[model samples]
Target: MENRNPDRATESCLVLMLKSPGRSKQRLAASIGPLAAIAAEHLCYCAFEDMAAWPGPVCFAPADEHDGGWLAARISPADAVVPQRGRNLGERINHVNRTLRMRGFERQIFIGIDCPELDERYLEQAADALGDHDVVLGPALDGGVVLMGVRHEWPDLGELAWSSTRLMADLEQFCNALGWRMARLAPLADVDTFEDLDALKRVVGEDARPARRALGAWLANDGHRPETQP
Candidate 1:
């Protein structure tokens, strides 16, 4: 049974899944260098800035238990912190959703900080979609989903394909099997490789919040890669 917070029973919340910078952006790290962690942190900062004025509730799911304090310092004091649990991506997402649903946030949107283009308008669209659809998905150009929101508890997601090109299709079939009405937002890009980072630099250059603009400038200056000791 899901626990319900009476005060927030009718509210919608954004659940951001994050990891400690030291442990994030593994693929980017493999492609770039030690600077992947710094890049990841900057992306998260951009996300934070984007959500700073969101009208709805917001919470964070940290991959590690010890990151609560670290996350706390970056978010508003009213935001909640939930520790992620599960062996795999699918399971972990399920765990976070279930936990939040139990806590009285009936409508919830989940996103990762990897999508630098994600902003307040995109989130508002998802929240609005939930009013008419059971689920809303923001597709990634790489055949994955960058954002997912649900108005009700999801069916068994343990077996769904994750982190693969087949993920979007698998999720659609899963939702179809359960007769859930799913909506899709416009596709976006995620920063997972050196090439993606380069693309993000161009994106933030045109129009971005303060944090993202700073990130764009850093990328322009090749700040992501530091000089190695001889």
Candidate 2:
């Protein structure tokens, strides 16, 4: 993709932290059954579209090394496919952050496929926020962060409460202790449950991205059953 903001393009990069589509969104699976995998793929496609449109560099970090090929095939050929290494979320994020920083990307923004509303605009906002603040967080409505951007290497995040509602609070407190300047973006909902999907459908009406529109159609028509059963 062409760099929309050429001035900051070289220094900033977006890291997409992802798990295999077949293995993701287990919580949503409880409500949607096996269709969660299908939904996961759609969410992945949504992220791919956003990343392709991003002005700066974009990298994909797959939880498993075995999924590297799968991700590489989907992302832009120029985008790096870095496999994640860590027993937990915090460690994994720290590893990717450290790795990318060493690769000359001083400003790194991390996001997941769970938030379809995340787009190039949000990526640009996060990149811009990193210019003045030491850290930038895109607050998720469920008391978590949909996006996290940093201008410098992060402190030990291994102890932070990840994937919990206490995540946002814990992160803020951690940053405060280190005296890091923090900036937060507007809150957005991340899809995790059937209720979350329902709320999203009501908002993403016509003119939504193709992947998102297809997801909405599948949910409205076939309902829980995916177009093809796995």
Enumerate clash totals for all models, in the order shown. Answer: 1, 0
**Model 2: runs farther than 4 Å from truth?**
1-10, 225-230
TM-score for all models, in order of appearance: 0.90, 0.91
Identify the runs in model 1 with alpha carbons over 4 angstroms from their true place. 1-10, 225-230
Q: Choose the strongest candidate by lDDT.
A: 2
Name the candidate that leads on TM-score. 2
- Give per-residue CA lDDT, model 2, range 1-230, as digits (tens): 22245456446888899987888899999878877888888788888877777777888999996578678776667778777888889999999999988888889989999898876666777787777789989889999889998999988899988888889989999999999999888888998887887776665556368877877776666565544455
- Candidate 1 lDDT by residue in tens digits, 86-142: 887778888988898888888998888889788767777887778778998888899
